[model samples]
Target chain A: MSDIFERIREKFPEYFRSSHSNFGDDTILIKPEGLLPVMGYLKDEEGFNVLMDLTCVDYYGEEERFEVVYHLYDLTEKKRLRVKVRLREEEPVVESLSHMWKNANWYEREVWDMFGVKFLNHPNLKRILMYEEFEGHPLRKDYPLRKRQPRVGPLN
Target chain B: MGVKRVVTGVFGEEGFITTKLDSMVGWARKYSLFVYPFVTACCGMEYMSVSCAHYDLDRFGAALPRFSPRQADLLMVVGTISHKIAPVLLRVYEQMTEPKWVIAFGTCTCTGGFYDNYATVQGIDTILPVDVYIPGCPPRPETVLDGIMKLQEKIQNSKQEY
Candidate 1:
């Protein structure tokens, strides 16, 4: 248990779920509602200034189907923290970190494109990797690997 | 030179030769090919090696890469064609002038390689008529040269459009 994790847990006990340290990598599972407050605290107070990555994972059959993961880094303290928010299958929406980090806009767009995870309050939420006409999220577990959509050009 | 020698052998003097306009056009087209390299993925590295001085694509008259499709006579698709890029590839192919040829420069372009997924376009042949297919993940320079030679042979044999 790192000092930062202990402090974060103490600060937001109501929002905190289960947290684990796997091979020195600290990851905290928090409720979707607590995302903004917790991330803001980490960025402003705890010095997790860098949002290294923002991605989503689809657990196809699980109760909480999708997990939006955020990797944060503290440049001054030389530490990394992983924050995850699990969402239900029906409506997987999480608070956008784009306001805090400029790069999160594109990352959120990519996550939306790949996993169909909606980032609420994101300025420009659109497909970043796949084309505009591409249907269905390709990175989801249920997405058929070989299922190709209608092609764009002539079939000659 | 082959046509000249044949004419000289028949007439016993090296003066003039008679040949079909199609063969003459084909011979000229095969010797001066302007390549448009539509490189996207790892195959571009192999393309670079083939076009560079060591491998020398200049031998086949395809050393210069015309960035614009309208200026090129040959379209060399050198890497994976994702579904998103397929439309653009088709547009580029359509932009090229008449008497143009297409070369699928890698296995990805030829047969989609191993990327059998929703994103990747299975093969480029679905959209454009391919003249030559250079099969390799990222084909060696030697294989590319051989493919070019094969294209030259095809050009020399096929009837010219104009």
Candidate 2:
């Protein structure tokens, strides 16, 4: 483990769960509540200034069915970090990082649109890719691949 | 030339020739088609090739592409129509002037191609009446020209509204 990872582990001992470094990429599994503070620390103290991506994975049939993943980058050190938060399928809610990173607004909206994971404080958490009248989230594991919704014209 | 020669022959060198007004109008409409290209995907590249100097859609009187629907008589849907854009496509079709015809310009617009999913519309015909369907993933310029010729024939045969 790198010095920065050791510093993070020491700083947030209670929130730190487990971490793995595979193929030269470091990923940390943190508690859901620790997202905002840990991300803030990474930004203000550790210099991870860029939030590269935020997305979710659905491990269907698991106890914690949804795993929200965040990829952060440090511009100065030229390093990357992956943070994950596991949430139960029944209530897949996470803290919005829009306050820290401006682009998180749309990222969170996309996550909500695709995976149906809610960000508690997202400014506008509506469908970013799909139309308003679209019924179900199409990216979920159970969503039938070829299932089509009613079209928008008289011919339909 | 065929219709005019027949009329002139029967009329015996008369200055004027008489024919059905519908045929006259169809002939005129087919020769001066103003097309609106509703381009939304990779097929637009093929559409460009067909319209440019190499293929020359000008020979077929479909070289002029009107950006607005009001001035166009032919609506060439040139790509995959997703569910989100379906209403917008319908609105454009509705906004076009009377005597308008639709051409599904590629396989995506004709039958949704291979994207049989929740997002893509199965075919544009489900939303708007289609006159000609050009079947290609992104059809060759020759194929597109053939489709245009087919559309021209259809236009020349159909009854005119005005």
Candidate 3:
């Protein structure tokens, strides 16, 4: 009932580009430019509906800053798929999936807030956790980990 | 009126004290407790263990939790409070009436643990007035019980009585 990607590979092999480098059976690392089209097909053609979680992993010393992880789930087949999109430290741009899922609104915002990954078409993309006044992205390894307290009151 | 007064005199002050001293009659010790379950993420599940059948909080006479802010006496913040949720949390704490106590449960709530990230609020105490801080990264069931016991001790030892 569930192996939809296998069917895609057999029938429309050109549509599903082979990413042999650092890729798993259910996971694919795609170029930033190819992200939008691939995601659209995955959502519309394949039955992966739920956008479960969107997070990023920082490989600090590397030339590329982060490895963004997008976890998608299919309610019909009860199958899960994870996709990775690698971005350089400077000028990280990926096509936003806000158009596809409502849950992506907060997920993308969090990723932007934490990893500083720029999503081109994301609307109202802001920090979900930190205050507007906060300066640096705390999730970034380069950012210093320091506690900030409100000036109005003594520490509880 | 005179007959009633004579009957009351017969009952006497000694009887009044004795009746109030009885265990079931809680008139003299009416300020029992109304704990606000400030559950955040995971530790809340363990707190359920204490409040539910296994621990039996009613036996101590402090199990009942009042949902409305005005009625509750304690704010048991049981989980992590992110910086984004901090203001709302503070508002909730403010809504609670005077003589309220705050218990910062879990290491994340108390110290923020290994989460040196952007979104996580380092310590809940920085925003709200925390009275008792419980240490544990989502503390174990036994530790939660210990925190409750510690709160009980604090209640007994409190000078400004309710």
Candidate 4:
């Protein structure tokens, strides 16, 4: 696993910001532009078979505000990798992984619904958990907890 | 005539049953509650346990769980009601026939539990008028049974307008 991690680091020096093995897991931070290509490489050549989870973390009041995290697992090798991509606060857009792993579709939608991060070229990029009329992403740091957007009528 | 004669004979006997027609109707309605289990989250497990034997919700006369809202006389909104699903819940509640009752089962249904977020509704009472609130994170079967008894009491006390 360490050898593979080293090899990946050596192969894609331009794509990687930093990578390390800690807590018995290998983690790699990839730039937004290199996200698709890196994930493609990991999926095709490196044999990360399953995209276990795709989620977002909001680092509010920061220049690069969001981190989209992807947990990939190699079923045959019985190994795991954590891939991350930071996004600017202004436009947090990342390439959709729906084409690589079918399950990324809903996971991406959930991320989008919660954090308001956009997934480019997603087949159906719409709110999966929230209603269409819901204003402001709730998971964003600026979103007030008490604020409510009511779409339904009051029962008379 | 035979039934009336028997009733007269029974009525003539001292300390025999005597009650108004409305009271009798209320008594019947109280016992024969056809509950619609609107189960959504973790509280559904507790609901399942309550309905099953040992806990035996049938003993209270609300054993029959009607899936269709039209057939249900009681709506047991079990688990969390999210803002997105609130409309669906309201629609189900509306479909129930008149003289209907609602028991908000579990803390989530009663007061949104710990999920004080954007998605989860604060409480079902914001939409539907809840009759009995079974208070617990995922209340014990005993608590649920107690809630049913409380609802039964409410049913018995209700004025039969329709």
The most accurate candidate by TM-score is 1
**Looking at candidate 4, what is the lDDT of residue A58?**
93
Off by over 4 Å in 1: A153-156, B6-14
Best by DockQ: 1
Better of 1 and 2 by DockQ: 1
Which tens-of-lDDT digit does each residue in A1-156 have in candidate 1? 477768988999988997889998999999999999999999999899999999888889999999999999999988899999999999998889899999999999999999999989999999998888888999999998767874674432
lDDT of 4 by residue, B1-162 (tens): 011112456456643455666667778888899999999999999999999998999999999999999999999999998888899999999999998999999998998888877778888998879989999989999999999988887777778765
Fraction of true interface contacts that also occur in model 2: 0.74
Q: Write one digit per residue (lDDT tens) for candidate 2, span B1-162.
A: 114634356557765756778888887888788999999999999999999999999998889999999999899999999988998999999999998999998999998888977888889989889999999999999999998888888877877787
* Model 3 chain A: lowest-lDDT 10 consecutive positions: A147-156
Better of 1 and 2 by TM-score: 1
**Whole-model Cα lDDT of every candidate shown, in order:** 0.89, 0.88, 0.72, 0.87
lDDT of 2 by residue, A41-101 (tens): 9899888999999999999999899999999999999989999999998999999999999
Q: What is the C-alpha lDDT profile of model 4 across A36-107, one tens digit per residue?
A: 888999999999999999999999988999999999999999889999999999999999999999999999
The alpha-carbon deviation from the true structure for residue A70 of candidate 4, after best TM-score superposition, in angstroms, is 1.4
TM-score for each of the candidates: 0.94, 0.91, 0.69, 0.91
- RMSD, each candidate, Å? 2.2, 2.7, 6.8, 3.6
- Model 3 clash pairs are B107-B136
Model 4, position A143: C-alpha lDDT score: 94
